[model samples]
Target: MLLQHAGIRPHPDYRRLMRALRLHAASPRGELAPEVYPADVANFFRRRRIPVAIVREGNTNALRKILAQVRRAPVMALVRGPEWGNEDHWIVLIGEERGMLVYLDPWYRPTQRYRRRMTNPVFALRWRGSAFSLSRGQAQSVRRA
Candidate 1:
């Protein structure tokens, strides 16, 4: 909920998950930034001894694996937003509710969701203990979190 970094949009789901992981963003001067880079996210998990896996676009096999993980715990995802359909956005997937993939999207009101079939997720971030092992393909990349 805090936009402490310049040139970054507020992403509620990202913030929520980061807080859940007990990680905080800090600026070069040790001030709160409330913004993080992709590398920073990876580093946080690494320091916490969590495992991370990355799935690229159109990887249905990996997508299926992530979906299974979501049944047990929250997962972070990057997808193309509906607005203008050009921007890639981040959201937290908090598992299924009544057959819908519940979204903690910052751009929408609370409790907003989409049908699982409607989403075209490009990337996924899953942590260990809550997720199964990622099946890495030539298109999939794995990061030790």
Candidate 2:
């Protein structure tokens, strides 16, 4: 969806990745259960040769650096959603508009401002342009710049 919004064609290999993830399951109530780890999403992009910098959650200083980076490019992050009682959710940091970050959410039709529901992102994964650059560090640790 982010790729589509960015006017880029998604790689077909992503389909295989999603299938392997088993994103859907049958519940006792006959409902579809879908869940994906943030690592899975990061790995999916890694497999495609994208550079990724994983920043730790709650690090305001590091986060500010990342936010600044996104002002020049796009990024993907795992955050808590307003509707799901702050459940884990994925959103893309497309860019800034009128001094606000623009996000492409899978559950909504329109783009929303970063202040809406991204109140404390658990982590962030930044890539270089459409391609990602790999960073060295613990996946959950945000190194001081």
TM-score of each: 0.45, 0.56
Model 2 has a clash total of 5
Best by TM-score: 2
Q: Tell me the tens digit of each residue's lDDT in model 2 across 30-140.
A: 776466666566666555544456654555566676676566556666565345456666666666665556666676655543333232232333222222223322132
**lDDT of candidates 1 onward, in order:** 0.46, 0.50
Kindly give the number of clashing pairs for every candidate: 1, 5
Off by over 4 Å in 1: 1-37, 53-60, 109-145
Report how far off residue 31 is in candidate 2 (Å): 7.1
User: What does candidate 2 score in Cα RMSD to the true structure?
Assistant: 9.4
Tens digits of lDDT, candidate 1, 1-145? 1111111222236556566444565667888754434455555445543445654445567677667766655556655535415554556665666555664666665555332323323233321212222222212222223
Residue 94 local lDDT, model 1: 59
